[model samples]
Target: MSEVIWWKRGVIYQIYPRSYQDSNGDGIGDLNGIASRLDYLAGLGVDAIWISPFYPSPMADFGYDISDYCDVDPIFGTLQDFDRLVERAHGLGLKVILDFVPNHSSDQHPWFRESRSSRSNPKRDWYIWRDPAPDGGLPNNWVSNFGGSAWEFDASTGQYYYHAFLKEQPDLNWRNPEVREAMHEALRFWMRYGVDGFRVDVMWHLMKDEAFRDDPPNPGYREGWPDVQRVLQVNSADRPEVHEVVRGLRRVLDEFPDRVLIGEIYLPIERLVTYYGEDLSGAHLPFNFQLINAQWNAPTLASLIAEYEAALPPGGWPNWVLGNHDQKRIAARVGEEQARVAGMLLLTLRGTPTMYYGDELGIGAVTIPPDAVQDPWEKNEPGLGFNRDPQRTPMQWCPGEQAGFSSTKPWLPLSDHFREANVETLSKDPRSILSLYRALIAFRVQRPALRLGDLRLLPCGERVLAYERRLGDDRITVALNLSSEGQVVELSSRESHRVILSTYLDRQTEVATATVTLRPNEGIIIAA
Candidate 1:
């Protein structure tokens, strides 16, 4: 509404392909399956969609380890099916953003294969390859984020290759001009196909310290990794040269009008802001992940809200994410009753918001059986227990068998609670979280303040969290009772605000002494 791109001001729905909708009865969702659901997505008021990877892979990391950068996997669909999906999404007024995994590739990828061949091969230097230490140990003390050593021995080359994640996902050597150019060509292929943009995976790891120094010791331990120690010097995949690579990518995006580039950086706000590039044109939004890590409380939430607003680079866009394919769903994290409060916070924030699919239906994590778990992190990190299978289960659409997700059995079991949380069940209930999410999305669409506004935090009072979003002549203030009890916050004398939206079970019209009372875990948006 504030002269921003439509994709920037509206919500982005993230669909995990393997679990979203399966059409071929193969128990796994594909491109055609997602194309068939365009009407449902349109009805949900989403402006765009960001689908997870559907590229060819060995399914080692559930498609994150891409074997071919330009081709869709047989499990997902053909490239023609993908083009049809892109065409259909655009026809329905939905922009499509693809997941670009430039950090690493499946070990089976041709580039990796060539890189791992004889050291004399022209592509041998395309990936990060190094000699073992004098003691035949890993090149350094670096550990993979997934766990264990990041280096793997290549018997053919007699050298070790770096893989920041699973061994199958070998890290690319961006330091190689040829490698960077090849990846750039991959971008050209997608952009030429009319894809709107990309959600860069582990983008920070594009560049690494070339010297391969030993990682410093951890300051403290949680389960196994450090809590306060900075992994930048040793393990920070985001090297200084990453900016040059980003500039190259940004230039590619600049070639197309209205294209976007978002990066997933799991770092703190300070380090995250650097991804914006000093030229004010790098990653359009380095996802704000503080809320994902912050404790669910009034003080912590208030503090983080202020920190993120101030920490973002000047003129750079901000985006909020409550849940993703890799993390626990909000309902499972904060309880179903409080999930609406989290939704209100997300939708009412002053920037773009990305919604994980099934979140609008208040879906919770499935109780995964031990045999059905497929997350490599859980399999490798035994005692740490970092399983993400429950969060990536199939979307529940109805009360029928397989929850109407697929005619056949699904890759992961749907929760029994799907009988109550399915879209069909929530569509008929006006008081459901699904309804509340729609109302807020519509409310955001009609408001300029919530889209591109400057934020002002109101004074903290009586278990309430309040803030004002202002854009030009438009202004809206939001208040939330993050606690389990009611809270009363006084409003300005001349400010008679109308309740534009609320996530409470029912609306309360009573106002006592210019103070509005909020029910347990309630949130409201007021426009003056």
Candidate 2:
């Protein structure tokens, strides 16, 4: 057997807990609901699930504003319910990875409360607090990711508390050793509960510039973009100290067996790989969101894959994510038919693929009304059209009431295509996107060429992307047509090839000749 780690050879499924499935008619998904869906996830052949935050929170930024890192939110479940979730998920052979938000904690958290209580408090330095600038304005030009200034002035404390996100979520002082130890203890707490790993939220934003330097303007920023793009976050994000932080986190995670540390970073590929740290001591996989932001064209995606593959440090594993809770749905970003092609590219590429929950069904973003906007960013800037609620609706389990996600109305409205775009409805159709995903995942898992292989992008022209994944004697060739118009590519290989899986699920013709024909928006994996 190969010495590749399980995470290196497996795919991870992201489950946004609040919208995954609601069991108790509370209009919100809880731990029991997630537990109930274990078999469904297992049947999909995913090796692990990275659940978004379900910790006790004030819901200022939904679950991202964590009030208690150790306990489960009452709306989600209790500590016992979380225990049951981990146990059940592990029993089903699915590793459970929790979302670890070490960057910031809710202002309601006991640590922040004590830190902000009085300047003389024992934990006063646990969170970042600074005095006003010379003009008595704000500290500096640091921008909050949500919008507006990064500092929130506290009248009682006579200093400004920093928050990279919403004001309710204060930035934790990673510079302090005591704060680092406390956060490390949180990791230990979850590890003791049998959790497999963590997907650290905003891993690049852990350490900010100590001098509080003003962020410079983005020269390339265009009109009609989100306001947060107005300034380049030079001093606010992706500081060099974060790798040291990652090393410490890796040390804590090293105590466990077969565990993984995945970081959520949106940096350039060159800077992103450094999180792997010297000697691979940082994150095992700093999520590559390049696939998410890349244009849906062969040339664009081909260059992105090549650049990312070249950027990885020696012994550093690669991972891919097409969509996540914070971004637009892949189906909506690309078209519905092309989502399958995107899925193929995500899985067939030489990396561990993290599939967002509802993408397997080609689910599009639901329309969110002005009054029902849930994202704090949307509320902060209503004119920017940056609301994330449309992509966070409840999971469509069946065709029944509330799409069988809940007995009562769900917290968010169900998608309009819930009837046809559900697990039950698609389970019966062999050509459905869910079926395609199952087939692709099963095939990808069983093939060493797909799992533990070297990636080599072939020169197949601009409209077609062809790559080979070769492992010793085993080899798999993949061809993806980026356009709606049918195209053809010539493979250099003279050996015969058989179709393993196709995006359209009908192209099974063997490709023994140099020229290979393709259907519009088709993606196929061929056994070489």
Candidate 3:
């Protein structure tokens, strides 16, 4: 195994810092809080931690709207605090990956402030700005991901600026050479600070169509869907020029050794694969969210996996994500019972797996009260269920006050079952979802086949998804039952295999016959 293949074979744990832990008791998680918990993460067996943005910001987008590219947000802590956290993480053998929000900057950022000051400002072209239509309407029909027009009219400059998300986050112009150099310099700054890698945010939105054409109407638009969904986003995002920008970012990472670049792209498999760049020089991992978006049924997931595997560019590595801060918890999307199955699926897949902070404990989304809603999306588009607060609530560490996430009340409500579903409570139970996650991660680490093997889909019943991972003589077969009822899967080989781990966490060392019986919402890993 290559020493630098840690990213390829290791699990990446994502930390939404504000909800992870609060050391100062300010009801918000900070860098010191995360550093204090490094041992806990090391015990969980993830090889790396990908923390969400903690850059200096106005908090309009909860740290995603970066104001200062090189400084830590006061709410998160100072530069020294981040350095200590990275040092502690490295000491524990954990890689540190920071969120790189290169597509846009907080409207309050100095760059944007200067760019919007006047049409002839030196930084005027740093962001996407255009004159209004002949009738003084929006620059184009582009819609913001949050809501309404993507173009935010600037009264002072008599021009409109584009923001794919909140107006507070003005989109940067990657088309500008100076803008690209600045973002690249920001990346290099972090890289020099001992950061292992970066999870680039809205990477596909870095470049827009130069023609400024209006996006076509979405044929599948529905009334209750987000306003942004009304358009196909053809001209506004995922433009062909984005690949060159991605390659440029890759070149910056190449300046540092053993550093990975993972792009958060929401495009389809075909378009997503393109971000890998020619000869796979773009993102080391263009996050494969098919598992997050696909139907949980066995056939749907089976086909989706096959399609994604086939769509990868030559030598392009694959990665999987079941849940994230922006989406509903995996346990909430699928029932609690199936969350274990999901964990097994995520850890056993044939590539790097990114685990959301609280999913290992089978933590589901909390119900956020109207008064407690913090997500800008939910506030901007009320009653449309665009709320992410439910999923972005504080992590349930224990059953104590604030679920041990903070001494004070958490910024958002905790799940009703936090008392029963927290790590302190679940870690003691061998059959708990948390235990299953640990065992699966350990099993993956110990087995080369599970980590770097070629995958082959196995023949199985409609309700059972089965596959084999083989690297030389090390062979492991994974069978998952996706339904409420039990499932029976037949192995191609009649040789007896030892069950290494199961979602139920009760089948280790058990010998499985050629025919395997999987309990409801159960998945198993067997070694030959």
Candidates sorted by TM-score, best first: 3, 2, 1
Q: Per-residue alpha-carbon lDDT of model 1 for 335-365, expressed as tens digits? A: 8878999999999887899999989989886
Model 2, residue pairs in steric clash: none
TM-score of each: 0.96, 0.98, 0.99
Off by over 4 Å in 1: 224-236, 508-513
As for lDDT, the candidate ahead, 2 or 3, is 3
User: How well is each residue in 340-362 modelled by candidate 3, as lDDT tens digits?
Assistant: 88998998888999999999988
Q: Write the per-residue lDDT of candidate 2 for residues 1-528, one digit (tens) a residue.
A: 347777999899999999998989989998899999999999999999999999989999888989888989999888899899888888988899999999999999999999989999999999999999879989988888888888999999899999999999999999999999999999999999998999999999999998888889999888878767889887888898888999999999999998899999989999999999999999999999998888888888899899999999998889999999888999999899889999998898888899999999889978887767778898888877788887788999998999999999888888999999999999999999999999999988788888889999998888898899999999888999988989887766676777767888876665556677788889888875
lDDT of each: 0.85, 0.90, 0.91
Q: What value does the lDDT take at residue 388 in candidate 3? A: 92
Which one wins by TM-score: 1 or 2? 2
What's the lDDT for residue 239 in model 3?
91
N/CA/C clash count, model 1: 0
**Candidate 1, 302: how far from true, in Å?**
1.5
Residue 423 local lDDT, model 3: 89
In model 3, which regions exceed 4 Å deviation?
2-4
Worst 10-residue lDDT window, candidate 2: 507-516
